[model samples]
Structure formats: structure tokens, C-alpha cells
Target chain A: MLLGVNHKTAPVEIRERLAFSNDPGVPYRELKAIPGCEEFTFLSTCNRVEVLFVSSKGDETERKVRDFLFAGSMSYDEAGKYVYLYKGEEAIQHLFRVGASLDSMVVGEPQILGQLKDAYRTSSDQSCTGVILNRLLHKAFSVAKRVRTETAIGSSAVSISYAAVELAKKIFGNLKGKRAMLAGAGEMAELAAQHLLNQGIAEVVVANRTFERAVNLARCFNGKPLAFEELVPELAHVDILISSTGAPDLILHKEDVKPIMKKRRNRPLFLIDIAVPRDLDSKLNDLDNVYLYGIDDLNNVIDINKSERDKEAVRAERIVTEEVLKFMLWLGSMEVTPTIVALREQAQEICRDEISRTLANCKDLSPKDQKSIEKMASAISNKLMHHPILFLKGEDAPEDQRRKLAIFRKMFSLDSVSRQDNGESD
Target chain B: MGDLLFKGTFLLYLLSTIIYSVFFFSQNKTVRKTARMFLLGAGIFHTIYLIFRYFEAGHTPLTSNHDIVSFFSWAMAWGFLSFRWRYQIKNFGSFVSILITLQLIVAAMSSSEVRELQPELQNILFPIHASIIITAIAFLAMAFCGAIMYLLQERELKSKRFGFFFSRLPSLDALDTLNHHCLSIGFPLLTLGMITGLIWSKQVFGSFWSWDPKETYSLITWLLYAAILHQRFTVGWRGRRIAFFTIIGFVVSLITFWVPSYHFTGL
Candidate 1:
């Protein structure tokens, strides 16, 4: 069933309005209210809002989902444009893309995949996913895997944290024995510091507005922790410096660093001013060997990585498309197999009963005659069913024949055959 | 100990470079893989050949202008091999292979006249310095890969074009981190190597900070990383800017190695 709202459907306010509440049992209650509903999963992230369900009523059950999303407090007219509906195959593909990070606000983000899995697990734990949803979720996992393996999208480094380390290596020919200072200890700064550590920068010092955040981030990246105020005094000790904070304007200006540069005897300092409104003063680049690059400058690296990895995108797309087609073929084949099984089992049951009754009625018949009668009945059933089952195996079988088989199963009261044999229905 | 092995390996690297360049432009995946494998094989053979030459002279192979340059290329090839082996990255190995091959070609051009091993080169400490220095450069080679990634990433963003190389390269953050991590490990190793070198120099030359071309270049390389570390920690420079400098620094270090040896008449 379709259940997602994005930038197209909802504004930031509306999306945030329908975002996940602290209440944990809301999913179960909402899903339980839908008719024929057997599964309930919701994936809510910064870029998307989704509610996945398994209901035989399908689109007819949309009203309940609508009510759950808006709580019927307002009209759908205001926010409906931002929503796109998907069902069956389309819905499955959407979920797969979402999980694979292809549909993410930032493509190739690894977080969405884990979030989708968590949502799915929550539904499963609440006894929401029935046979249909179970198959759908499993299929989503495979599609995600196929995307990851066949595409280079996931390999490129796009985030700010990685870009920081790349810059560090640039200023320094080699990272060996270099020292780094991470100021503000914002998640961004911490992440950047981690990248610095990974780039082979040995000594790392984290200084944050709050001492504890610095300590925590330092501990996470295995860097030496420092205090916030210690930044100015220790400025000369570091080779590369990263800063991110909530300060509205320039916390580090040319004035603050000019003296440090002089004291350091003109040794270069590569400063990464990553704050949105800008952290360091732009004029600081005037200093010799003092390379200051901003968040936008990181785009250059991001673009290049995006292209290099994009070269493999065609290969990955072909894989996903082929897999989807293969899945559809298997799904198509499944319909015929069930009807054939239903027909054969019914015919076999009748043969056994009739043969046993005949043997009982003729008490004078010898054991050899009875055995022969049973063998003959079995042979007739096998020979009768062989051609029909073989025809079902054809990938390009006639639609009329397929439909007729379905009608036969329905007429014979065997439409609800065992579902255990179903395979790869995406 | 003969010049033929050195020349032969140099030729092999040269051949691999052409093959890799062809594969890159032509989009020949099979040929690219083959060329990289060939480069790796050449590197292996080159290592054996260098070791034999080192033994023959009863000194480190990095003693002369010829062998040190050759060793630098050898280190780079080994670096490429390790990076490819660790990541199983199939396509980009050729880029670094070409670079390493060129390094060896330059080394081959330098005088390989086989001068007598000097008394300063007599100590076992000499060989230790050679190994550490080569190892440090090898790590830098991985850093170079990161730099290439950074440059490629920036170009893609500017052009608004994304392709296979675009995504295959590690993330801007990942590459930066990789560059940083590689440098961190390599820097310390280099520090120890430099320390050992200083101790040996002090014992032999009666001085530790002579500012020889090799020593000066090493300091400059160290200072470049020092600046990177400072900027990353103090300010927030990253990605392409960082990568550009990392690449430049490594290239300069390469030049420094070659230029100074020629002055010292290791050529």
C-alpha cells in the first residue's frame, strides 16, 4: 500500500506536524483499525514520512491511513500535492529504493536502510506483517543489496567529516606525525575529527563549547580530549584545525589567528570553516600557508566523487531492472503452479476414494487384483495431469489459459491452496 | 647487483603505465585489471631485484640516487598493491600504477653507476633507515590515492556530472578521513624513521640537523602535514582543498628526493 509524504506532498511544517510521536504503540493501533490489514510499519526520517501496511482491501482502505496521518483535524487539500501513492510493485520498488538510499534526501546515505529495517522489525514484532508483507519486506532487502553491489554510489565520500580529512592531507603532503585540533565538538566537528584520525593524523585534541561533548567525541575517535578555552593557547601546537559551533557569527577572525601565525614562524595552518553562516573570517586566507576552505568548497570534492561513482550507475540500474523483471516472472509463474497443484490434489483424492470403495464392495477380489487396481488409478492421475502442469511452466504462456486455470480453481473451491510453495513474489 | 635488473624492472613499470593509460581511456575493464596485475607483478620482481642489489653492495639499496629513486617507485607500487588488495577496488588501481611506474622510470634515468658503499652507509642502521623511509612513502602513496579521490570528487561537483568514478571514489569525508588516517600512522612511523636517521647521522656525521636536501625535504613534507593537521583541527579545511595539497606535497617530496641526490652527486 502507498504511504509516504515527502517535500512534494508536505511543507516542512506539515511534515514535522505528522512526524513520529513518542508514543510507541501508535503504529499497532492505527494498523489494527484497517480492514484486512495484517502488517504495520512506519518509516519517518528527515526527508520522508511513510506508513506501510498489508491489507487485502488495498486502496479502499486509504481513508484509515489518511485519518491516521492528518488525524482528520485538517483538510488533505493543503498537503496532498506533496504525497505520491504507490502500490504493489511500485510500492515495493519505492521501499527498496528508500532502503537502498537511492531515494534518500542525500543519495547513498546509509542511515535510511537501517531505519527501514527497524520499522519493518517493529511491525513484525507487533504481529503486523502477514504473508504478503513478509514477502514484500524480504524482497526489499534483496533489492537494496543488489543496488549496493552493482552500483558505485555507496563508495564515494560525500559528507563533511570526510572532506575535512581530505583537506588536512592536502596541506600536508603526508599525514604522518601531524597534529589536529577539533574545536566546538559539534557532531559535525566530531565526525570530521574522526576522519582526521582515520587519515593517519596521529595526535588529536577536541575542544568544544561544552567540555563534556569534546571529551565524548574525543573518546569516540580515540583523540586526546581538551577544554574549550584551551583553544587559543594551544593554537600553535596543531597543524590542522577544524571548528564547528552554534555561534551566530565569526568566533575565529583574522585577528585571533594573525598572532598565532606569527608566533609559529609562518608555518602553515589549514583551517576548515564549516559553519553554515561561516565560522572563521574569510580574510584569514591572506596569511601565507593559511588555507581556509568553507563548506561550499567541499562541493568540488563531492562533485568529483559523485561522477566517478556515477560511472557505475548504469551497471547498477541494469541489475535492479533485471532483478525486478525476474521477480515479476517468478510471481507470474506462481499463479499457475498453485492452480495445477490444487487440481492434481483434488483428482488424486477422488481416485483413491473410488478405488478403495471398489475393492471393499468386491470382497471376492484377490490381493493381487486389489494392488493392480490401485496402481492403475495412480498411473491414470499422473498421465492426466502431466500436460497441463508442463504448459504452466512456459514463461510466455497464453493469458487466456492462465485465467481459465484460475477460474477452474475457484469453481472447484480450491482457490485457497497452500501458500508455502510461493517464491520470489516482489 | 647488475644494472640490467634495475633497468629491466624500470622498463616493466613503463610498459604497465602505457597499458593502464590505454585501458583507462578505452574503458577496458579486462585490460585494466590485467595491467594492474602486471604492475603488481613487476613491483614484486622489483623488490627482489632491489634486495639483491642491497646485499651485493652490503648496504641499503636506497644509498645511491639511482636505487633510492627506484626504491621510492617500489614503495609506491607496493602501496598501490596494498590499497587495491585491501579495498578490492578494481578500476582505480591503474591510476596509481601509472604514477608509480613513472616514478621508477625517473629513477632509471638517474645515474645507476654503482658507486662504492661509503663508510656512513656501512652501518646496519643505514638499511633500517631505508626500510622505514620506504614504508613511510608507501603510506603516503595511499594518501595520494585519497588526494586523487578528492580532486575527482570536486570536479564532479563543479561540472554537475556524476559517473562511475564519481561514486567509486570514497566519500569526500571518507577520502579525507583515509588521507588523515594514513598520514597519522605513516607520520609516526616516519617520525621514528627520522629519529633513527638522526641518531645515525649524529653518530656518523657529528650532526643531526644538517639541512641536507633529503633532510630539508623531509622536514618540508612534515611541515605540510603539520599545516593540514592544524587547519583541520583549528579551522575546518577538507575535501578537494585538502586533497590538492596532499597531492602537491607528495609530488614535491618526490622532487625533493630526486633533486637533492643529484646535488649530492648520488647521481
Candidate 2:
């Protein structure tokens, strides 16, 4: 059973309220009292809060889990309006999609895969996941890997920092040995600088209103801190300038950037202004060899990247569907095989008893005739069970397969074997 | 025998060109690997063809339009393969292969008849000069590819449309770096080749600075490249502007190499 509320359903207020504040290990402590929950794993992220658990009384367990999470503030019916609950096959499919990032708000984002792995790992360490979930989660991970390798979904940059880096690439061609200047030590600007560094931008210079803040931010990234007054001079040496200062007025004007472009010998300069009021004059973009992008531009790039990823998602969806079917087939065979085997064993045992009784009574028959009679009896039972065995193993829809399996077990009185195979007896 | 090898090389290049186009669209790892293998195979056959032509003609095979164009195509393929081996830009082979095949087709259209080497072309410096110049042209061709990619990728980034070409092409930084690397490699070789040609001209024609159309064009091509290199190092001229300059340089080189060789007998 899977119960979760993601960004698509719940508002941030509700999600944060239900989130485990500090300890991710709190679920196991609380789940100890929930009866019939054989295994449990809780996943809480910025975008989602979920619990995947194995329980014989799935409906009751879901209610209890919801009550525990919402803490009497909401009932199951009210929660059902926002929360998604998946049982058996639906739950498995949900896990696969989540692992593949198809269920993510950002369709092809890579973070969900790693997050899923972390959730699985943490749960396993806490003894909350066992044989079934262990196999299922690992399968989900491999499916995610396959999706990543087989499609171009994760190839483009879709975030602000990434978009800035991508724009820098457009202006300069390659960032290797190129220098980047951070006009403000704002978090967004710092993120863009880090992205540039990862793309092989050789040097980073951070300039902030507060010298100490600049020094602290620069030290974190192993970068150099530049004095705020030196921003104009430092622009000459850097290929990219990311500005996100909180100043009321513009920090850079056309006049300030024109000379820097000249000093740099008309080398391309990329200006990324992430600040709301915009740190640089828009007219500075008109300078030759200068490319300027504000926050809106980065968002546009992200939108483009997201749309491209959405197209590739069609292919990824097909792969997920194929994997889900394969897992379901494996699961179906797992649940049905023991009952089929038990039924066949019962048939064979009855055939042997009937053959033994006939052979003992028919003393006049030759030893060869007695053996032929036993063989005939065995063949009759095998022929009778052949169609049933084929039906048990054949490809049917999940619902139809379940119905047939239940009927097969009841008809043959094989509930004990089925229950044993399921590791449950009720 | 040599003609058979030439035809084999041409067919292999054609096959590889198609495969590379597929690789570009699909971006499949297996298809990329196969396309690269085909390019290598074509290069081998092309090398053998060039060697056979050299042995058959008893000189470096840059005497006629057909020979020189084919030789240029061979150089481009070899240059592209070396770049790919070093940089591992798998998508780049699509563009380079198309350019190579286009050159080969132009070569095929021209008569393959061997022409007698003119008196001034017979000097030892002529072969050295021609070899270096042709190799440089190959590098410039790669630079041209990089420039085109840079412009297209830049457009994608600026417009935020993120279309098929955007996904298919490498990053702007990578393309820019490729363009820069190509320019650096090509410029010096071209300079050396022009100097050698000047020396050869002095030895044959008693003048090192003749204003022949071909020589004038070579000078123009050389100056354009020099300016590009200068601006790149000093003024920090890069990306779209540099890419455009490299493309213009390639066109000028083509005209200088092709037009003068067909119309003029000697330098």
C-alpha cells in the first residue's frame, strides 16, 4: 500500500505541517503500534510526504497511517481529497514512476531518483523494509537507470543556475579557464557561480556590499572575494558576471560596462541579473560582445528545457509501462505458483491411491497390466489439470488474474498453500 | 586498382554519412559507436586511395581540380577523426561527415584525368606547401562546423525555443572551445604554408611577392585568420563573432584554392 501527498495535491502548508521535523527515523517508532503493517517506509521531501507499507488490512492501515500523520486534524475522507492511496499493483506502479521521475512535478528531474534511493536505504537500515519492498525498490531503481540511459530526458539544464551556466556557454563557447564575477553574495548568485565553477570556469570573484559576507561566501567555494568598489575593474578579467544585489538602484549602468567590455578587448561578457529590481541597466545588453540575462530569461530557458524534456517523457513512459508489466507478471507468478503446485500434488496423490486400491483388488491381472493401469490413471489426471495450469500461468489483466487465482484456490481447497506462500494466514 | 580503392572509399564515406545522420537524430549510444566505426573504416580506405593515387601519378595528387578536391575531402575526414578521437564529440561527426561527402561529390563531378604538372609547380617546395595548406584547410573546415553549431546553439539559448538542433548539438561552451581549438591549429599551419609557398615562388619566378590572383587571395585568407586569432587573444572576441569570422575565412580559402588552381597554370 502507498499513501502520499505531493506538490501536485497538497499545499506547502499542509506538507510541511505533516513532515517529520528533524528525525527521519520517527516513522519506525510510531509504526510499532500499527497492527498488521508487516513493513513500512516513510519518505518526506520538500515536494512530497509518503508512506509505503505492507499490510494485510490495507484500508484500515491507511486510515491509521493518515491519522498518525495528520494527528486528528483531518479524517481519511477529507484527506482522500488530497492524498493519493495506491494498493498492490497501483502502489508498485507508483513507486516505479516515482523512481523514474515521471511522477515528479518536474517530469525529468534527476533528484527524485536519488531521493528514492535514499528513502529505500534509510528504511532498510531502520528495518522497515524487507524481502518484498527490497526487491521492488531495487527494481524501481534499475528501471530509473534504464530510463536515464535510454532517453535524452536528463541531458538539458532546467534550473536557474543551470540556465545561467548554459547562457554563459552560448556567449563564450567554453567556460574552461574563463572567470566569473559575482556582484552580490545572494544565494541565487552564489548558486550560479557554483554552476559556473562546475562547468570548468577557472576563477570566481565574489563582490558584496558587506566585505565580510563576500569573504565568507568566497571562502565556502574556494573563490576570491573582491571589494564592492572593484566590481568595474574585476569585470575586465571575468567572462561572466552574475549580479543579484539587494540595492534599490542599479549597481551597473551602460557607462560602467562599456569600458569593461573595451578593457577586456571586446571578449564576450555574460551578465546574469537575478535580482528583482535588476542590478544592471538593460541598455548594457546593447554593447558589442555582451550578453545579458535577467531572471525572466533564465525562467524562459527553463521552460524551454522542461518542454523538451516533456517530449522525451513520452518515450520514458513507454519504458515504464513495459517494466511495470514485467514486474506484475513476475508478481502474479509468485502469488499463484504455490497454489497450482499444491493442486497438482493433490490430484497426483488421489490418482496414486485409486491405482493402488485397484491393483490390490485385481490379483488376476499381470504385473505389466497393473503398471499400465497406474500410468493410465496418472495420464488422466495430468490431462485434466493441463488447461488449468495454462490458465494460471497465462497473461491476463491484473484484476482478471486476481479473480481467477482466488477462484482457483477456492475450487481446489488450496487456501492453506496460498496463505503460506503469501507469508500470511488469515 | 587505385580507382577501385577510390570508389570503395567514396562508398564507405557515403554509408558513414547516413549512419551519422541517424546517430545525430536518435542519439543512441550503440548507433553512435557504429557510426564512429564506419568513419574509421572510411578513413582507412581513403588513406589507401590517396597512397595508390600518389604511386600511380608519381607525384602528390594536387595537380587537377578533381585530385585536389578529393584530397581536400580526405584531409577533412582525417582531421575530423583525429578531433573526435581527442575530444569525443560524437554528434559532431554528423556535420563533418556531411561536409566531407559534399566535397567528395564535387570532386566526383570534375574530370579525374591526371594533368601534367606546370613548370613552377614542379619544385620540391610546391608539394610541401600544398600538403600543409590542404591540411590547414581541413582544420578550418572543422572550425566552420563548430561555428555553425555555436550560432545555432546560441540562438537556442537566446530565443529559449530549445528545438531539435538545440538538443542535438553540444553546449555553446563546447562548440566555442572546438572553434577556438580549430582556429589555433589551423592558423599557424596556414602561415607556415604561405611562407613556404612564397619561398617557392621566389625560387621559381624570381619574385617572392607577386600580386597574382591566387597569391592575393591566399594573402587575404591569411590576413582574415590572423585577425581572428588576434581578436580572440587580445580583444577577447569569441563565440558568435569568432564563429562567423572562421566561416568567412573558410569560404575565402575555398575560392583561393579552387578558382585559381583551375584558371591559372603556375604561380
DockQ of each: 0.07, 0.33
Q: What does candidate 1's lDDT look like per residue over B102-121, in tens digits?
A: 66767767777667767777
Docking class of 1: incorrect
Per-residue error for B206 in candidate 1, Å, reads 13
Model 2 agreement with the true structure over A26-117: per-residue lDDT tens digits: 77788757876777788876668888988767678888888887877777678877798898888988988898887865455677787788
Task: Write down the worst ten-residue block by lDDT for model 1 chain A.
Answer: A417-426
Query: Taking the tens digit of each residue's C-alpha lDDT, what string does model 2 give over B153-222?
Result: 7776656566888668876667877988988899899999999998998998898887878878999999
Q: In model 1, how large is the Cα lDDT of residue A224?
A: 76
Query: What ranges in model 2 sit over 4 Å off?
Result: A1-5, A13-38, A53-97, A130-426, B1-57, B63-67, B88-122, B156-168, B198-219, B255-264
For every candidate, what share of the true interface contacts is present? 0.00, 0.57
TM-score of every model?
0.52, 0.63
Interface RMSD of each: 10.0, 3.2
After the best TM-score superposition of candidate 2, give how far the Cα of residue B173 lies from its true spot, in angstroms. 2.7
In terms of lDDT, the best-performing candidate is 2
lDDT of 2 at A26: 72
User: Tens digits of per-residue lDDT for model 1 on A365-415?
Assistant: 889988999999989988987876676555652334444555455566563
